[model samples]
Target: MTRTNLSDIISCLSGYDPDAMSVTQARQVINDFVPPLATFEKLAIRSALDRVLAQDIVSGINVPANDNSAMDGYALRGDDLPASGERTLPVVATIHAGQHYAHNVSAGTCVRIMTGAVMPDGCDTVIPQELTHAATDGAVTIPAGAVKTGDNRRRAGEDLRTGQTALRRGKILRPADIGMLASLGVAEVAVQRRLRVAFFSTGDELRSVGEVLTPGCVYDSNRYTLYGMLKRLGCEMLDMGVINDDPAALEAAFRRAAEDADAVITSGGVSVGAADYTKQIMQQLGDMSFWKIGMRPGRPMAFGRIASGDKEAYLFGLPGNPVAVMISFYFIVRDALLHMMGAEQAPLPRLQVVSRSAIRKRPGRTEYQRGILSADDDGIWRVRLTGEQGSGILRSMSDANCIVVLNDDQGNVASGDLVQVVLFDGLV
Candidate 1:
């Protein structure tokens, strides 16, 4: 519906079960309604912990930069070794790491070197000190032994070379990648700006968690839950706090949340209910779509945009139930947020796990049954159900280490069956 027609709030956001919209269909709608935000900024290297690389990082110098010893050894020209007996090679000069070489190996000569020391020039092999006999002077005798032409020597640029792509755009830098960049002597990196997100909860009956339990009022948790997950992704967030279920208050909160955020996310008020003002107010001022995606515990989720001049800030309305929020974040918003950040599109990891019990489910909705993964003695991962799959029971979500992903077309899963398990460790 157009913004003009949306001015009149819909008393009922469709009765369509979240399963009515397929994941593909929902993603398409999200793409059509919410476009990516404009790019901005020169972020500091240390500040870009999880941000996507906006530009390709190239090495200015080779990793290792020069040939160095992989172990403590004697640098010698293999061909210069004597045919028999102890070949006395004068220890010409020592070459240690981080120091320039003043002497190169001459014929019948070698040097005592430590691991990481520059391989002396004109030396083709390294005889680890343990393999050789000691001498009185700064010299060692080499006994006849097997020696490869260039063993134990790490060549310059062997790991990476100057002008080679060290890191690509859209790659989320891991700890190893960070060290690799540092090895290239890169103290700074160009990365996409951290997405600024805003979050809030809406319900007149909800009270702050620390406050005393009042009659008919439950503790507010959506704001903190969303905040925690987003924080783990390195998001810059603004907590909009809680706006009571009143329409005017909801409208003011929505306006403020969209004011400085790339996205504004809420936990409730988009379902087929009369009092869900978050949906009503969103319809009035922005072009937002409320979809009941075909997914369990997360069917009431919505995705769209806030009209901001010629642009629209993205919006994701999560379900009120705790488990539904987790599911929506994993199956929906996470990818879109990654795309928005310019990170390369990597498919979410999926695993084949053995089910410990039968799961009752329907064909239309994809169910994410919370479960604990057990590793057998053979080291294979198997999944077992966590008691009662109620979406509102936050404890089950907390104790769960993985989710058994039941396909949309499949229903009940019997015990001893192989199923897909999406791990909570970020790997799967």
Candidate 2:
């Protein structure tokens, strides 16, 4: 790609109103950029769970290793049954889960079997133990109509045929995937390594966690917040702690971040503030596209990267406000992380819910309002905003289970109006 001037970036990002980029614009910018190529690491299946698969997995063996019984029952040849319901069949033998029978089930004969025991040769039906009455005299009188041929029989290779592709590449493994692999006797899997993420916070008034909070200083949140969010995305994180507003310190942090991480995430000190050193560092050190997005609580967001030799690393400067960081991540960086891990175009969870109260908004900018959703008396889910929309109110975010999203083209939404909701679980 050629060099993109600041004016071109701004004009291209003006799809949202208020001369600011929206979440859609932010996503388009990255989706249009060159994504970092991912690598794979062979880890144990336990570790590979929830990670995207680097290659497709084919079945190594039949799903069922052998033809076995589907129930704790008696295996017999039903074709030899008498016309009447009474059929006195002498017990030819007994078959447990492991031991093999000495002989095949003969005509007018049956073998006592347990669930999961391989069916003896010549036995085509299984009569459940509860349906048959047996005497200790080596005689089991099974009703003629108790079970038919092929009843309670599990056929081998029914679920998955050998050499078939069970799971495709780029698909994230889940619990069921684990079970499927286990059925094929696969004890390990090859998965992409966790994305390496470097994160820190920059502000003159910020302090580290567990430290005493001063009158004007607050405990740094961006590091912990981004750490947790990245953890959920299966990323390996290197926390740089808190970087001050000093230009030298910020530059040094960038040098380390460029060397160690595939992506660097920072919060605060990106806006047009006197104490902000990020802008100065970006201008001097590397090419970065910084802009204000047209969304509540997250207007001051930046996405860019620096080139070192033939290699490059991403940089994201999020607004310092706690809520802004969270909202911006959901709309901007989550999909990028997913793409880096070889996931298919990851999309946010968009849900539809009714409005419980009137929500006012201008018709030019998409807004995300932290909301609590509940089903009303009519069994309809309704969503409404939390008390305040300020970026400093962490409690509002904690109290909300989802964000009620309103598009830029939509205006005020009255009660009973339908709105789309994006759940928080998807963000993490």
Candidate 3:
């Protein structure tokens, strides 16, 4: 299929405004610009965690392969069960897991079956061992109302059937998915190759760890945080370290990153008043756009693709502020990379929670405030700000459990008003 151009996509969008790019508009455009790499590799199921599946996995056989007992009980024909009184029957045989009874169960006879043991033919019910009385005389008595027909029997292929799709393509494998694949007797699966992401921090005032601090320089923390985030996303990282703000140095770094990586991410030099040569160098190399997105902490962003010689890579130029860099990567670049990796996972749902204190906000732009989500006095889930919310305040993000999201049309929130929040950690 021919790839769609970014300009064509933007022109088709109704109500598009370039100067005041809405959060939704910016995300949609970025998603359209990037494409997933068409490559896959086979790996053992145990080693495929968090990797996107490249092909649909179909089951070759039924999961359980037989009707089995879910508990240690007596398996008997349902017709032999007394309607309202006690019933006693001879214990014909005992069936253990991985073993089956050779003879069919007849009326007035039952089999002592262990958990996961296959039920004998003609047996439709299982009365738990704890609910029955067994005697030394090879007889068992089931009390009235012990169990209904098919109460404890698990049907064959209940969990998965032969020729059925066990899992679809583009799913990120989790623990349960690995177990499921094992149950289906899958030894290996084809998954997308890990994405190659090259990142760097730019600024003349940035210093590396262990380097002597200059009078006006600060230690670079963005690279460390970016490493963690990219590692969590399962990308092959290429840290290019800190690039000086000199025009020639920045240009060389951009060219090398584009030639070697699928995507290039740089912190600083995108915002106004920092450096004019950064934007000029980016445009001279590729179709990059510097936009003032209508969002808090991450408003200044440069996006598009850059090229060197015959190779090209997508670029994400984010702000230099520590908190702003983290937020931009999570809210903006994360989704784009997931798409580039061909993951079809849905966006995380924003949970509705009450605000414990009033939040000062303006309308027109979206605000993402660092929040501490906890249960209130009534044990109801609520969110409160983590004190200061400045873009440069990294401590606020460190102390937050979630990001309280106020939409573009939302105004200042009252103390008791319900708000939307997205958690940093999840069960998946």
Show where candidate 2 strays beyond 4 Å: 1-18, 34-36, 77-91, 100-103, 106-108, 131-149, 308-311, 375-379
| Candidate lDDT values, in order | 0.77, 0.81, 0.90
Show the lowest summed lDDT stretch of 10 residues, model 3.
Answer: 271-280
lDDT of 3 by residue, 159-180 (tens): 9999999999999999999999
Better of 1 and 3 by TM-score: 3
Q: After superposition, how far is residue 286 of candidate 1 from its true place, in Å?
A: 1.8
RMSD (Å) per prediction: 4.5, 3.7, 1.5
Q: Pick the lDDT winner.
A: 3
- Cα lDDT of model 2 by residue, 1-428, tens digit: 57554445546654544347666777777766636456788877877789888888999888776788999878888686656667878887778897777687888888888898988998888888888886443778787677778899989887888899999888889899988888888888888878888988998789998888989998987778888888888888999999988999998888888888888888888788988988888667676777777788788877777655565578888889998988888777878777777887756778899988898888877888999988889888889899888898988888998999888888999988999998887565
Error of 1 at 204 (Å): 1.7
Per-prediction TM-score, please? Answer: 0.88, 0.85, 0.97
Model 3 stretches with alpha carbons more than 4 Å out = 1-3, 135-137, 274-276
Minimum summed lDDT over a 10-residue window in model 1 is located at: 4-13
Q: lDDT order of candidates, best first?
A: 3, 2, 1
Model 1 misplacement above 4 A = 1-19, 31-33, 80-90, 134-137, 141-146, 308-311
Q: Which candidate is the best by TM-score?
A: 3
